[model samples]
Target: MRVGIIGFAGSGKTTIFNALAGIGGDVAPGKAGRINLREVQVPDARIDKLSLMYQPKKTIYASIQLADLPGQAPGSGGGFDANSIAKMREMDLLVIVARAFDNPYINAPIDPASEIGGMLAELLLADYTVVEKKVMRLRKEAAKGTERDLFEQLFATLEAEQWLSTLELSEQSLELLTGFRLLTLKPVLVVLNTPEDKADHDSASELIEPLSSFEAPIFALSAKLEAEIAELDPEEQLAFLAEIGIQGTARDRFIRAAYKSLDLISFFTVGEDEVRAWTVQRGANAQTSAGKIHTDLSKRFIRAEHMTCADLIELGSEAKVKEAGKFSLKGKEYITQDGDILHIRAS
Candidate 1:
């Protein structure tokens, strides 16, 4: 999935993006419409343990794609550039960085609440524009029925400055609105960029608590402090986190936030040849999830020999798990669970 990093100028989004992607993402100021894209592996200790146990020729971890966009201050006469808006439309999720720290270069007062609120308004305005234009065009054409009615309902919601996602729509209405790609409909994660002195994970709770109305995942970290450390190797990174007294790296926290916001889970496939982690929706069925591994597996799916990663680790082997009756064969309709190690049996 592609996630966009966005915020107003001097919010340190590039630093956050670099931290998340493990890259030196730098763009010269005053460059309009620039977007930097990078894909980073989603860190999971489960994959590490499985890799160690299997001694695989190769280990594969699921990755998330990130895009960092040029910072644009909201309420500016010129809103998001057409190109920037287009780029945002292509993203599956949005990460809005709000400034809570003082930056000497940024002249404006630091108000994360106002910054995020204004940015959300921008998104609402953008969507409202699209719906309004559509509704007007339909009226001009003397259009009536579900199509007009749907957008009319959307108009009322957007008119109130609420996200389109708040409206409950049928499958048909959802399909109809799919083409618009409303910005507010995308899952959002809010990150507060705070001063180094206040970098403690819980320090920004007050700032975040009031934002509960956004109904998005929220967290705080000092991007400037974490950016450089993100370049370190895994062992060194862990050492640094311990030294800094933070529970985890900024990247791991951000990944967890995104995963929770999206209701995602990872399943594994292990062998001597390869050990890989695959991400899927929480409640995806066995055959549906088999398609994440391979289409052929889903097409010819028989039954999956499923065992929990915890079971394997506890019992010390697949044989032991089977001996304990912890390994069972599940049919196509079986709901996939987190950390399930699946061996798909296909024709």
Candidate 2:
């Protein structure tokens, strides 16, 4: 999945990006309408254990593509540039960074709610403009079809300042609206960049309490602190986190939140040669999941030899798991679960 990091100027968007992507050093301020893309491996302890047990020659983890888009300048008023909006429209999710930290360079007070409110309003305005223009074009051409009706419905939602994602529409309507790439239709995760000295402060909660009405997933972290932690070795990092009484790094929390926001899960394929984690939607069935590995496996239409990772771990090996009757044969219609170890049987 692809996620975009977006926020207003001085909101610490790049700092979050660097922390999550494990990149360090100076990030030159991005120009308006530019996108910085990076690929990050999704951390999974299950894969690490499997690799150790199987002695695989190659081990691969599921990854996500992250785009760091330039921040919207405060009071730009006209909304985001067309290029930036187009890039963001292609993302599966958005991570909005709002500043709650005091910076010597910034004169504004640390008001996360207001920053987020302005950013969200701009997103709504951008969608409204797109929908309005589309509806007008359709009307000018006197168009009469599913596409026009779809735009009309979208326009209605945008007019009310409601996200299209919140509206329930038929599958046909949804398919018709796919080309529009409405910004507000995508899932959002709000990140409040708290001050480093007050990383565990209760002020973050107060700042976000009013935004509960939006009902989006919200988290608070000290991006500056996280960036510093990212520069440490693993052992040092753990010690530092313990010193601060933080359970985990911001990267882990952010990635987990991103996965949850997208409703994604991971399935595994294991062998002596390779142990890999594969990503799929939560409700994907055996056949659909096989396609994620290989189309031929799906086309041949056979069964899957599967067992949960927990079973394998407890039983010590695939042979032991099979001996215990923990390994079962699943047909194409069987729904795949997270942490399932699957072996496709095909022609």
Candidate 3:
């Protein structure tokens, strides 16, 4: 799961990315294609619980890839170029950081409504350009099939200043356009880069009220404060947040929002040697998700012994779950559920 951080010029997107990345030193900008990518473990209570129960030598939580794509250069006239937009299309999710705090580069504070609207408008226009080019390349006779109809439909949506995400394409139709990565179709999380005084997430809500119309998950944070908190130890971080009257760190909530935005879920594999969480798209089948751990496991797949994590913990033991008939064998086509513990039996 990869997420790209994007915003207009002087949106403080890189600062937000550095805060979430929990890395030392600021990411130097102004270079083309210079991205700071890192894999950060997602904190999961279920994995923690299973780790204790199984006493694993090594425990691993699910991790998402976060990339700090350089923001639009100051005085670049806002919005991203084709090259920059291409980079964003590679992500499973997008974190759009909008400027809310006063900045030296920006003359005035950015209004949440205008910032979000402008950001989305750029995406819609980019996609529309792609659609138009596709149509122009097609011969008149070739522009009458289902493919042409799809392009026309997309053109209409983009022309209306609406996101393609609003349209629900069927699985087969979506697969047909696998060659094209539409910017508006990707899931998005909107982050308002606010001042330290507006660090509290709740108060930030009112700022994004106008953005409620968009499907993207919107939140606000002070990248500076989050970065400072990121530098502290876990214990000290919590204490600091409490001192400031904040509930939790932006990193945790940000991850959750990304997961929720796409309806993604996690399945676990636990043992005495290792207890690990794995991420998969919602409704992914057992066989498909097995590839997430190892491609060979998917090819040699047979059956999966599955049980819910909740069942194991509530029933007191794996033995009790089997005794209670809560444990079952699932075929390759069986849909994997969130919090499921899967043990694959490969040939």
- Tens digits of per-residue lDDT, candidate 2, 20-51, equal 88885545553555667999999999999899
Residue 166: error of model 1 in Å? Answer: 1.3
All candidates' TM-scores? Answer: 0.94, 0.94, 0.92
lDDT of 1 by residue, 1-347 (tens): 88898889778888888878777444344543567789889988888999989999999998888898877864464567767777888888898999888877667888788888877877788888889999899889999899999988999898887888887789899898888888988888888888876675677677677777767677888887777677678799789879878888777888988888878899999999999999898999999999999999999999999999999988888999999999999999999999999999999
Counting clashing residue pairs in each candidate, in order, gives 0, 0, 0
Q: Please report, as a residue range, the 10-residue window in candidate 2 with the lowest summed lDDT.
A: 24-33
User: What would the C-alpha RMSD of candidate 3 be, to one decimal place?
Assistant: 2.2
lDDT by residue for model 3 over 9-44, one digit each (tens)?
567776777788886345444444567788888888
The deviation in Å at residue 109 for candidate 2 is 2.8
RMSD of each: 1.9, 1.8, 2.2
- Give the candidate order by descending lDDT: 2, 1, 3
Q: Evaluate model 2: give its TM-score.
A: 0.94
What is candidate 2's CA lDDT for residue 82? 78
lDDT of each: 0.85, 0.86, 0.83
